[model samples]
Target: MSAKNRDNKNRWRNITVGFRVSPEENELINRAVALSGLPKQEYCYRRCLNQDVVVQGNPRVYKALKTEFATVLAELKRIEAGKGVDDELLSVIELISIILGGLKGEDANGE
Candidate 1:
């Protein structure tokens, strides 16, 4: 489907759905909504429809982890090239460094 079509499909929603629940169930629903960081209506709607609601972490942390994985793949490539695996195998220590650097509030440009 085209992006325009998808946008049009999402442009309007008119149906209203309601249900009764105990106080404990209400509290649990509210907690789930809070953790999802989505509005209560959206969270509840998605949940009722069995849609996956992903809770994403900090983008910087995600990028840092991606870089760490790439670094590991590169190290493996080196080992596959008949290079001696020395302390270089411990280079994954840099993964922590990358994660820390990203968590320090730096943007993608490190600015």
Candidate 2:
């Protein structure tokens, strides 16, 4: 048998939770997870609990940000070509802005 899982508070985490989402939602969640530099489970747990998902700067997160910037650039070019902006793209931009803002704040505080 595998070892039991416990949360930071030492609470046993045995219950399983499951949900379904559309492809668009899945893509958004995956992007957020990647950008947060946290495991998918931790990200979802924090989000569900309405707790802050603090992002720590690391190679994985930096790579995710770079890839996301490329996606945003392509989307902006499409918009310039007369295509309307999609909600998913806007959501991604908002997430990126939040992450960057937090990082900026950290830098200002020399953390």
Best by lDDT: 2
Where model 1 places Cα greater than 4 Å from the true spot, the runs are: 1-8, 58-111
lDDT string, candidate 2, 90-111, tens digits:
8999899889988787553447
RMSD of model 2 against the true structure: 3.0
Candidate 1: worst-modelled 10 consecutive residues by lDDT: 1-10
Q: Where does model 2 exceed 4 Å of error?
A: 106-111
TM-score list, all predictions: 0.43, 0.91
Q: How does residue 29 of candidate 1 score in lDDT?
A: 62
